[model samples]
Target: MSNCSFCQVIDETLRPGGIAIWLMKEAKEDIKYQVPFLLAVYLDENVYNGALNFNPWRWMEPENEEKRNRRTSPFYAPFGGGARFCPGAELARFYIALFFYYFETTYR
Candidate 1:
């Protein structure tokens, strides 16, 4: 789920301090920055417990379901966000569900 994000700084900005300053100490205006995704989905300790362990039952847990319904988990952006959100996200989900339903019934 790692992705590179590229954008130009619209205005000059200064960091308060303590963070590792990259390239310019201060973000200069109109500078196009190429930043790689620092967080890998599977490696993210904030989300999953262990990558090797498959725990589908975790989704059924009350607290986990609550977080999903609220959309508070930052690690779960599959269709992207904001104005660039995928227009067909809902359609894609519907198609997946339809396929699973047909496959289950036919196989059974």
Candidate 2:
């Protein structure tokens, strides 16, 4: 019953934010870091029909109650909190800002 936009995005046929490469890289890294957690969101039975007919677009559905709640609720903790926080978080932010700065200067 879903529109299957996530499939399109995954297949490289659709670019939601014009940043598919960035998204793909982040997704791949996330999967590597926490496969089970990512699967919990991406492979949940209620969000996806089956392993074969999987569709990540269904993530928008209310049926994914846990994910929806976590996304909307402020009670949830940030990814990697306290001393276990990501070491690359600051570097990633800096690189992203530099990318935007250069992109804007070069393109505009």
Candidates in order: C-alpha RMSD to true structure: 14.3, 12.0
Choose the strongest candidate by lDDT: 1
- How many clashes does the backbone of model 1 have? 0
Pull out the clashing pairs in model 2.
none
**Residues 18-98, model 2: lDDT tens digits:** 111121124634344533233243334544456335344534556543432322322111223245445664454456556
Which candidate number would show the highest TM-score if scored against the true structure?
1
Off by over 4 Å in 1: 1-39, 66-72
CA lDDT, candidate 2, residue 2 = 27
Candidate 2 TM-score over all chains jointly: 0.30
Give the count of colliding residue pairs in each prediction.
Answer: 0, 0
Per-candidate TM equals: 0.51, 0.30
| TM-score, prediction 1 | 0.51
